[model samples]
Target: MIKTAFALSFALSTCMVLPALGAEQFQCPLPSNPNDPAKLEQIRGLLPDVNTMKNIERLNATIATLRRDGVSKSLMIDHLVGAYCLMVVREAPLTEAEKAALVRRFTGQVTRLVYSLESGLDIIINVPLTPDVVDAVNSVAEKQGLSGPAWIAMTIDDALQQQRTTSPPELPAGFSSSC
Candidate 1:
C-alpha cells in the first residue's frame, strides 16, 4: 500500500485555510524547528486573508499555470488541495463536521497524489509479455519478496547505475574526474 503525505498536507492546508487573526486554533505558537523559528514565522505570516471569491478564482488560475509549466503533480495537488481546504474552512471555522467533510473529499486525491509522486510520476505500464518473460520476472521478483512493479523499478535503477559507472564521462584535456 502506498502512503500519503497527509501529515504534511494537513499542516500546510490548515495554515492556508484560515486567517491567523483571532484564530487561536490555527496558530502555531511554537515552531516545529527551534533552529528555524524565523522561517516558520515567515511562513505563518504569509498565509493570506483569502476570504473573497475573486481570490479563489485567482488561486485556481495560478494552479493551472503551474500545471502547464510542468510542475510536479504532487506539488500541484498539494496546492490544489490546500486551496480547497481554505475555501471550505473559510465557509465555516474549524469544526469537527467541517474537518470530516474535508477529509472525505480529499483523502483519496491526496493518496493518489503521494503515490504518483513517490513512484517518480511514471505511468504504470502493463506490458503484454510472452509466457517465458512472465515466468522469468515472476520467478526473480518472488525470490526477492517483491511485487512485479517493485522488482521492475529496482531492476531499472540497477541497470541505470551500471550504465553510469561503465560509461566514460567526457572531460577536458588534462582533466579527469575522480568520481
Candidate 2:
C-alpha cells in the first residue's frame, strides 16, 4: 500500500481526508532523508503548521500543490504519517489530550485509507497515550524501523504474549498443570 499513500476519503468522524494522486513522472520536492535540516525546512515551508494541517480542506490544497510540484506517493504517505509522529515527539506545548486526539484522528484516517475500514462499517482502534508515553513510542518506533500504529501493535503483542488473568482458570479435577 506504499503506492496508495493514503490518498483517501475517510469514513466517519470529521478528521483529515487525503487527495488522489495522478500518474505523471515529476521530481519530488523534498529530499530523501527526512532528518536533514533542509528537508525539515522544506516541509515547514510547503505544508504549513500543525494547526493548518488539521484542516482537511487546507491539507487537500497543500497536497495538490505537492502533487503539482511532484512528490512521490510513498514519500507523501511517510511524511504525512511521520508529520504527526514527529509532532508528538517535539517539545511543542501540547497537552496529553491534544496529542492523543491528534493520534486518534490520524490513525483513523490512515486505517480508512489503507483498509477502507470505518466507524460502524468496521472496527477501529483509537489509542490514547500520555505525552511522555507518546514521545517514547515515537523514539522506539524510529529505532526499530517501525512507525505509527504498527509500533503500538507490536508493543501490545509483546506485552500480551503471555496472557494473564486476575485469577487462573481452574482445572477439571484435583490435578493442576504448569503453563
Candidate 3:
C-alpha cells in the first residue's frame, strides 16, 4: 500500500513538472530587411512574447494610432498579417486548418505562418485579419463609421478593464481596476 502511494505521488509530480518543462520560449519574428529599418524596428518592438497579454493590447493601441494617422486598412493589414505569419512559423508547427483558425483567432495580428500542406489552399494563399481587422470591417460597415483604430483601442481598453474587475487576482499589486 505504501509503495502504491509513493508511485502515485511520483506520477503526480512528474505530470506537474512536464508542462513547465515544455513552456515555449517566445521570440519576435521580425523581418531582417534593412530597406525600411525604422518600420522593421517598429514591428520588432511591437511583437508580443507568448507569456504577455499586454502585447496584444499594445498591438491594438498601435493599430488605433495608425488608423488615426490615416494609414490605409489594406496596408496595415498586410504588414500585420505578414508579422503574424512569421510569428506562427517561428513558434510552432501547425496544420493548415489550425493556421487559418489562428488567423481567425488573432486576425489583427498574424500569429502563425507556416501550416501543414494538407489543410487547404486557402490557408496557404489568404491572410487572416485580427480583432483589429474586425474593428476595421465594423468601422467601414457603419454609415457614419467610427475610425477603425479608435474603435479597436476603445474596445480593447474596455475589455481589459472588464477582465480586471470581474476576476481579481491574488498577487501582483496594482493589477486590479475599478472598471
Candidate 4:
C-alpha cells in the first residue's frame, strides 16, 4: 500500500514539474524568411520599451539600406538580432510590462523591414542613427523644425548615460580619473 502511494505521488510531482520546466523554456523562433513581417512582429512583442522600439526601427531602416547595397536578407536578420541582443544587455533591468512592450515594437519593425527587403524595396534614405547617433540627426532636424532620428538617438544616449552614471564604474589600477 505504501509503495502504491509513493508511486502516485511521484507521478503527480513529475507531471507538475514538467509543465513548470516547459513554461520556463522560451524558444524564440527566427523567421524562415527575412521578409515575413508577421513573424517579426511576433518576435518583437517580447521587448520592453519605447526606446527599444525606436532602436529597432532605426535598425530596420539600416538593414533595408544594407539589403539595397547587396547584403543578403538572412545576414541582415542575423545582424539585427545580434544588435537587439546587444542593446538588451547594455540596457538594465525592466519590468515585465516594459519588456513585453519592447518585444512587440521590435517584432513589428523587424517584420516590416524584412518584408521590405524581400520585396527589393529601394533604400529611400540611410540614417545612421545610434543611441549616440542622435545628436547630429537632432541638430539638423531641429534646424529644419522637424523631429528626426537624433531625437530618439539623444534620448537613448541620455538614458544610457544616466544608467552609466548611476552604476559605479570599475576603476583600473593606477587610474586616477574622478568617478
The top-ranked prediction according to lDDT is: 2
How does each model score on lDDT?
A: 0.44, 0.46, 0.42, 0.44
lDDT of 2 at 119: 39
Q: All predictions: root-mean-square deviation over Cα?
A: 12.6, 17.8, 23.1, 22.9
Candidate numbers, best lDDT first, in rank order: 2, 4, 1, 3
For candidate 3, give the lDDT of residue 166.
96
Clashing pairs in 3: 84-110, 88-112, 107-129, 107-130, 108-129, 108-130
Candidate 1 — which residues are off by over 4 angstroms? 1-64, 110-123, 127-179
> Higher TM-score: candidate 1 or 4?
4
Clashes found in each candidate (C-alpha, N, C closer than 3 A):
0, 0, 6, 16
lDDT of 4 at 96: 38
Between prediction 1 and prediction 3, the one with superior TM-score is 3
Specify the poorest-scoring 10-residue window by lDDT in model 4: 12-21
Clashes of 4: 16
Query: Which of the two, 1 or 2, has more TM-score?
Result: 2
User: Candidate 1, 144: how far from true, in Å?
Assistant: 28
Q: What global local distance difference test value does model 2 have?
A: 0.46
> 1-179, model 4: which lDDT tens digit per residue?
32443343343222211112325332233433547564444334533333655566556556656666664444454445534543443445654344434544454355345544244564445645456545654543343222553233323333444457599776799998767
In angstroms, give how far residue 45 of model 4 lies from its true place: 23
How do all the candidates rank in terms of TM-score, highest first? Answer: 2, 3, 4, 1
